[model samples]
Target: MSAVAPVRRRRPGRARRHRQRHGYLFIALPMLLFAVFTVLPIAMAFVLSFTDYSVIGETNWTALGNYTRIFHDPYFTTALVNTVVYTLMYVPLGIAVALGAAMLLNRRVRAVKIYRTMFYIPVISSTVATATIWYWLLNPQYGLLNVFLGWFGIDGPAWLHDSTWAMPAIVMMAVWAGFGTNMMIYLAGLKAVPRELYEAARLDGANAWQAFRHVTLPQLRRTTFFVSTLLIISAFQVFDQAYVLTKGGPGNSTITLVYYIYNKGFGKLEMGYASAISFVLAAIILVFAIVNARAVDRENR
Candidate 1:
């Protein structure tokens, strides 16, 4: 009779439930912070975009006035054009430089870590500090770049001061400062590529260029897409270099959407207009992101 006593089976569901509870507990703080800081601010900005809510005085509802004014605003139009131009130049050039650097570093060379560190140093450097150094280096008179050009019998332009050269100069500094990051990303992508592909290409009588074109490029498509998307987004938001170096100067040659937003919001105390412009910028970014996602999905399929 004692041996006939039934043994109760423990439920596996209980352990899963306990684990789920603990997981939620672990993530609760981060979720709270995100909701409070990120989500709340965004929601507030959206609401503020419809009102004449300058930092001073009573707020008044403006409906679509702020959004409507953006269309006729010459400064906004100029900023938009400048942003697009910067993007066109920066993205392709940035990707090329990064890919080239990555390829160079991908070799089994001595002191590779040192080289990597040297390239990455600029990325970790303070933006203000880098801008200051670049300011000195780009000075029309006695700047290192112009001095080197002088030795080569090529006269250098006033990079920051000249309207024609301001954007290009900013782009150059941006590419130099930014490509290192994308280079690291590309290096990681290059490392992840199956070595068998290269070997197979060689067996098929492919040369170095042929192997890279057929084997390497195809394998790195996802990486390229990711890098390009990031570059596009960052290019659209470009402000610091223009602000620090040119102040959107030489008749607003380098003024970007973000710099315009800054001037509108803080400089002119037009918070509602600034908020509207920000949302417009956000919409543009969303559209690009969606397009990139669709392209990736189509490629994957």
Candidate 2:
């Protein structure tokens, strides 16, 4: 009578299945939208990259001809080089400005929110509007930038008009417009850094610079990596500023990969070739991202 049969707990298979069904239903709309908008377009572009698929006329397969043509295309080469140069200049400067701004604002000083807002205003401003303002500022004559230069008896270059200065001008504008967001990111990272670490550093006779170099920077490695990766991608894909300011002009000195792709796809109606070049650009961005991720991982280890 005391030896009762052992009871086994039954699995909630039906309830679990019901919950999973709801989860799928909840995500169905977003999944469908992503598939239709992102996945399908990428697939179509890849397929079209293998063909002579201009918007008009008959389409025909061209195999790897489109890819091959990119290597020999002078405009493409120039655009690629310009894009690389822009990325090289933009990423470092953007990081420096953002980090410096973040460090400045991380203090317990009064009116810090006002300063943060002022810095972030440009990030929220429309790209077209920002570029327009910069356009006026960089004008060869009567612009504020050159006017200030003249106060010191310094002659200013024709920024957007001069081939030598056009890309640098774009880089400057982009950095000004973009660094605010990264500054906010850095601000968040700085906030997350344990205050105890700084106190510890102080107790160890470390000065402000030493604490920043050893503790602050080390703690913010992940944040720096994330910010750098984003900056690299955005810098590589730069187009709107160049389009609005110079229209890839001054002898193509300001032409970028995205600008070149736009000219090929829409301006020239060479969609297939443009798609091929775009895939190449995608490959380059992917490589940089992977390298950056690996570097972060190595540092963490």
Candidate 3:
């Protein structure tokens, strides 16, 4: 019989080195694009935030002046408050509604695919179109929503007109438009949960609520964290709906951080001040995201 030759295995150290080199190739394009579009812009904005640049021309460095003005500016304070209120209203509501919708779809209901498609339609629709439609729907005199309320002997207030109602109206529209995508995400998370856990919960005399609380929710924690983080950031950056529906009107009730930034950058041509505000928004988002990550990491442990 012929002697068989021993097969040589690749060394782990060499293999790891190859993998590390290959990793850079895969990541190079994305890193390049991010540096160009995201990192470089952020750096530029940070530098500009300390200056007195405008559409006219660069004047001189006014270190911390823009940030100092932010503290004293009543409009900035109001915008910050409005943005916070909007985030509070929209984020929780969106997550709850999306979770509810996702749970419904998780059941073996008829036409589930169609239902998911219907729910997701609003998310993919153009924001401008959605805002325009919602604007008409919330109109005081001739809106469908008011007509329906009138039928039930309830007076519907001017939704986007009165300052008290304007922000809430925008919040409602935002939730409707935003939740569907998160619902799909939650649905995917739900699907990954083990059916055996539900069976075990039932065997232990657990009710539907108990099964969900014990098994489903625990499994969905990561997804919840991701969705909440995204929604919170988006809520802080809301601008298009306000621009189209209320124009930050009804006494600046719907003005948000992003709207304020747009007014400073484009309307007033104060790029440096706008950059300062943008950095503040970035800081807020970063703090929240860090908190969320830590909370999720603790839960995972």
Tell me the whole-model lDDT of each prediction, alpha carbons only: 0.94, 0.96, 0.92
What are the per-model C-alpha RMSD values against the true structure? Answer: 3.0, 1.9, 4.4
Please list the residue runs of candidate 3 whose C-alpha ends up more than 4 Å from where it truly belongs after superposition. 1-29, 295-301
Give the TM-score (vs. native) of candidate 3: 0.88
Better of 1 and 3 by TM-score: 1
Over the stretch 138-242, how does candidate 3's per-residue lDDT look in tens digits? 989999899999999999999998999999899999999988999999999998998999999999999989988989889999999999999988998899989
lDDT of 1 by residue, 178-260 (tens): 88899999999999999999999899999999999998888999999999999999999999899999999889999999999
Best of the candidates, TM-score: 2
The regions of model 1 sitting more than 4 angstroms off are 1-18, 293-301
What CA RMSD would candidate 1 show?
Answer: 3.0
Q: After superposition, how far is residue 98 of candidate 3 from its true place, in Å?
A: 0.5
Model 2 C-alpha lDDT per residue in residues 200-285, reported as the tens digit of each score: 99999999899999999999999999999999999889999999999998999999999999999999899999999999999999
Query: Model 1: how far is 201 from its true place, Å?
Result: 2.3
lDDT of 1 at 30: 96
